[model samples]
Target: MTNFKPGEVTTTHIHSDILNRNITLSVYLPEDYSDLYKSKVVFCFDGRDFLRFGQIHRVYERLRREKAVERVIIVGFHYESVEKRRIEFHPQGEKASQTVQAVAREIMPWIDQTFPTYKVGNARVLLGDSLAGSIALLTTLSYPRVMSQVGLLSPHYDHVVESLFQRCQFKDDLTIWHVIGKEEKDFKLPTSGERADFLTPNRTLNRLISATSATYFYEELDGGHNWKTWKKELPALLKYFLSNQ
Candidate 1:
């Protein structure tokens, strides 16, 4: 139904030594892309799935045409596979943090060199869903100056809440936009009754963000955990992040 033009989608690849994996990166440049203006960049995890399931390209095209937001460079970082995604994206262990660091240190610099980006302070943003959300949040905390804004949509909250608040350093330089579906189900542990609930932990994280003088926006949408919900929320998220421009 949707006809997308050529040059609207650009693809690249990054090899990370930290994870010992090759990551395929997909970038969507706005129609007016030129060397004249440095576009804002938004790095998103679960790259392949976001394209196939979320139809993000169409959404971006419509929003940009309507002037709902400024021009942006959407960088989609693809993981190895769905099975390995949990281990890679969950911010629960040391390896997860290592992978996040690799992305920040290695992959991002490569992108900057390859593309015409606005490498200015607070111009870059990180976005993800579910476990990828945990990775994005942790990565932002780890490199607050580099990753200034984050869009967390329906994150899985288990070990991340305590780990993020207790271990990471928060500064006023960051702006986090957190959104969770109210109807999203909570995961149950085999031995322990139930792990940390999603909504409450996100609220607690919000409170922590508020106390740290960081710009924060928390929203609870009436929906469930799926791409459909995320697709519905993407426009508003784009507006909020691009409002300053």
Candidate 2:
């Protein structure tokens, strides 16, 4: 077992001209990070929630200290409101594509210049939960040259499953770590009170991607669609993706 200690987290602002708002980012760097070394990075959506609920900094520190995973810088993108998250994280929302572009075009380049990053797409990860996971998938598909890997924790795949499958049929050198709870079969959407069955479509997506040439991992665990499950699985996912790199 690893002793989970908190890492150094700093706050910074990245200007997104497309959204016309300065998005706040919480950057977590390993204790040993320095200008002499370049590290991998994970860009996380729903930033504030992840920091508070996910306890990702502690997980990262434990993994890094134990050598269970490679050193990484986790960047948490903070959202102003639930409505704002819906617009930016939803697959078909008006600002959805623009949000992806902002991360790829604006945020990434800035991170590279500001920090000692690997500066390669394969060394970076796009991570998010629920609808944000949907956006992360879309962004990875759209900008594979910028972000080649994605961590989808209970992605809301109802609306985007078919289209994503169609895209996955083609050979894209992408790596994905996807997990959904068995109990997440039905849940009420936070934005709309409509009930959504996430499990079935997520299973469909797993099968589709498994058939494809891309590298993928799918886990259907016994839990619900909440941060508790995600937080519990975070260390394992980080170790899987960031380990021995």
Candidate 3:
């Protein structure tokens, strides 16, 4: 098959046995994608916002045009609704475990079948923001052999997630790019209207990751838990992870 365009996008839907629903994944091939390259694949949660609000395609295009770093294939998981997202992404939600199972059993296998994956345990990345980020954290910890890097953009951290981090074994190759806003110490969730202190919990998570042998980069950036900060920092996030710099 001839390469589509430098930044072409296509999509696929597959049924998730664990969630008992069909899920959509938007796939974006990088500027120079070819069989000769060992493709790094980034599986992002909260993908709608990552593409819309985060404008990752635009940023990724610029990175490629400028020849800033090595590029990766972007595969984004699109949630059906905000309510359903809560069910899947939240640590305490009804379908939380189901979401992880779906990714491990359904999504990851599908990715390997369809894409030119570099490696299962090294070049694969699992990432997201807020509650989505929390799911990334849980999934990575649960299946350390599946992914190497965890990209967390102001994730919603709680006691259960903290306990998991404290108890789980980290692969020596594990890397985390965690960015939490200092203002997230107290705030209301966008959809649920629930009050949460993300900063404090993320700080605790930072400490937990610090105790592990994993390569981790945790930072308290200037903005709160919103898309603005995430969008602005996304290029740096991509470069940091993709370039290993």
lDDT of 2 by residue, 118-232 (tens): 9877899888999888888888887787788999999877556457547643346799999999988887766778887889988988887888788888999888888988999
In the range 144-211, model 3's lDDT, one tens digit per residue, is: 88876899999888887877776667557688999999889888877769888889888888888887
Which 10-residue window in model 3 sums to the lowest lDDT? 1-10
Listed per model in order, the count of residue pairs whose N, CA or C atoms clash below 3 Å is: 0, 0, 0
Encode model 1's per-residue lDDT on 57-117: one tens digit a residue: 6777787778777767788888776557767887765468777888788988976876678
Q: Could you estimate the TM-score for every candidate?
A: 0.87, 0.92, 0.92
Model 2 global lDDT (CA atoms, 0 to 1): 0.83
Model 2 regions lying over 4 Å from their true place? 1-6, 159-161, 168-170, 190-193
- lDDT per model vs. reference: 0.75, 0.83, 0.83
Which residue pairs in candidate 3 have backbone atoms (N, alpha carbon, C) closer than 3 angstroms, thus clashing? none
| C-alpha lDDT of candidate 1 relative to the true structure | 0.75
